[model samples]
Target: MDLGFSQATAVIVGGGRGMGFATARCLAEDGARVALMGRSPDVLEQAAAALVEFGSPDAVGVVVDTADVGQVEAAFAEVGERWNDGLNVLINTVGPDAVGGFEDLTDEQWLAAVDGGVMGMVRCVRAALPLLRRAEWARIVNFSAHSTQRQSEILPAYTAAKAMVNSVSKNLSLSLAKDEILVNVVSPGSIASEALVGWADSVGVDGSDPYRLMEAIDEHFGHPAHLPRAGLPEEIAPVAAFLASRRNSYMTGANVNVDGGSVFT
Candidate 1:
């Protein structure tokens, strides 16, 4: 697909690995100048190198911990400075995956989950608003999970945090619509990102065989969607790229599901 992000500036939080990296590559391939922000300098460097290899010479890696508001502000400032034209896309993929039931989580753990997942996104978006406003048109794609729709006992805190994200995205969509800034959410299901594959490997699944690993994951986690297998990071990228591009003019405030057929909404 022709994403049409050429000469556009994109800021992807948590872009060093997994689905974030995949989205970065997709945008970069479409000629967007991308800034990848993460906590790991090594991983960010590698991701930036890969983008450069894939034809985004202006791709940069910015070290920023999204959980920290100051860092988020600084990161966006740097992005604005680098891309003087404006910020066309802001894709926030930062969030803590909180496992364990309600009783299992302590006050600290619950606070951490809210801090990392909800407030982190809040801070980043608040900081990026100025840059986004400068563009002719801007797209804000916040990450959510399909688990938020179906609900999960094991991921109570995580689910709550993502649910908050969905709510905020919808509110922001309405608030920013007049500015021509489209805000939407992408809720993914069981995607076989690198992190998921590593977990499968640790659990003795045949990670080498995609089909086998996905089958095992389905048996355990259950991805009863249209496709029999788990989705890939690459599979989620096109949807994200589309939502983050100029082509998506009328999709604000929508939570587009990229989880196979897991959640119909």
Candidate 2:
């Protein structure tokens, strides 16, 4: 299916690895000119090099910590100056998981969660709005968690921050509708990725041997979803690509759950 993304310019914040890299690959494969932004130059270079091999030879990597507003603005400006193309899509795949019960979370932890998850999206969208408005079609897909709907435990700060993301996306959708720039949210459940693995480690779970731990987690929580297994980064990427494309013209302000029906009940 042609997504009408050829020649489109996409800025994927946190596009170094995991779901971010997967989404970047999907978009570029469909012919979008992609700029990968993240904190690590090496990882971003690797991701951009892979994209170059796939199709987008002009794909560039910029080191930008999403948690910092100034860095995000600079990265967007660099993309604008280099590409001389309007921003067609902005995907925020920044993962800021603070593992701990409410009592265990320090003020610093909570603030960081809000900054990385909520304010990060806010900053990127604000910076990209002008460029996005220039495009005939523009999209902003914000990464959220299914836990916000399921109300999972032990993620007070994380859930709160994602809730803010959901709200912000919806509000942006309404405000940007007149300009034809779509804003939407995607919530995925238990996608197997480096981010999830690091989250497990932060929570004191041994995922160094991920095969075993993934099996155990699947046995415990996989039953809720109809698929009876965790999702892969690749599986989540196409959904995001569709949302960021012209094909998803009517889906603004919606929170699409790609959770294998985990939250249906």
Model 2 worst lDDT window (10 residues):
216-225
Root-mean-square deviation (CA) per prediction = 1.4, 2.6
Q: Model-by-model lDDT, in order?
A: 0.88, 0.84
Q: Best lDDT goes to which candidate?
A: 1
> How close is every model to the real structure, measured as TM-score?
0.95, 0.92
**Residue range with the least summed lDDT across 10 consecutive positions in model 1:** 217-226
Best candidate (score: TM-score): 1
Off by over 4 Å in 1: none
Cα lDDT tens digits, model 2, 53-153, are: 87776999999877778988998899889766588999998867776788899999999999988998899999999899877789999999888887645
* Pairs in clash, predicted candidate 2: none
Q: What tens digits encode model 1's per-residue C-alpha lDDT throughout 1-265?
A: 6777888899999998989999999999989889999999999999999998877878999999888788889989998889887899999988876778789998888888889999989998999999899988899999998988877667889888899999999999999988989999999887887777887898999665667776876776655566777788888888999999999888899998987787764
Checking candidate 1 for backbone clashes, the offending pairs are none
